[model samples]
Target: SERIFENEKVTVDTIPLSHRVYTNGFLFREKPKELGLNVDAVKKYGIDISHYHNIKKGKDVLLDDGSLIPNSELTFPPQKVKSYAFCSDTAYEPGIIPFVSDADVMYHDATFLENEKHLAEKTGHSTAIEAAKIAKEAQVGQLILGHFSTRYTNTDQFLEEALTEFQNTSLARDGKVFEW
Candidate 1:
């Protein structure tokens, strides 16, 4: 519900989630980086390293000869920015759509299957389909379902049901590691 960290490079924010107790999710977003310097262009222009800072900051350079060099010609675009969202120990909570919309990746709680919807509701947890619906509504790049109930003998249904709504959904396991 509030931003916890921020600088020129990135930001981290908390999102309130529907749970029996006080619960929150997190959203981590990387800011657009400075433009990359075209070393070949710099060398070709005979520009000194002293002007590197200003050029990267998007400033045009004025040569000693009074010739002007555009910043666009000195630097290329930056890398793509990325965002991540984490929601757990919570219910279907569609109210969080705005905060997580367009996230590159999202990890959501899916503690039950559709057959146990009543149990999940009572426990303030979400079913696999509900998590997938949230991911689809938010248009997130990927959905990671986790926090399963111990009673379930198999987790295939979770991935299966979630995939029906969001094709990029994946299951989270105890020792599993995810990148991007």
Candidate 2:
């Protein structure tokens, strides 16, 4: 299940990939589209306003000096748009794979270790191994494991377990910053 909120500024979506009662995840995405111009190249080629749109569209521009400027020289490539999936408090449900496939980053619940998978299932949560399996199946660029159960004191084991399936797996901690 999913709910989408949209307006002029942004669109937020709540995805229900969890089996626990009253649990959901969120996906935040940007909506603006802007073409960046290489000011130095534009000045060097003497490109005028008439060619701005074409340049933004990745087209070569004809300069007033009767020279041609390749789009690469006149404009910076569009910034890569990124997407993130937050899958906390969810069980090992493959149904969410399609929704988060190819996401740049995925934060999934790794509330227990493989040894305690029974407890994880009982609580509608996932184990570190299960989180890694989902990340691998989704083909996400990075997998972040969060919502750890307090039963385990050394969280490195969680990372170790998840890494066995997905090398890109990491354990989320406070003040941790992930960059694309």
The most accurate candidate by TM-score is: 1
Model 2 residue pairs with clashes: none
TM-score, predicted candidate 1 vs. hidden true structure: 0.95
> All models: lDDT?
0.95, 0.84
Give the TM-scores of the predictions, in the order they appear.
Answer: 0.95, 0.81
Task: Write one digit per residue (lDDT tens) for candidate 2, span 69-101.
Answer: 778777776676677889889989898888788
The CA lDDT at 135 in model 1 is 96
Which residue segments of model 1 deviate by more than 4 Å? none
Candidate 2, which ten residues in sequence have the lowest lDDT sum? 26-35
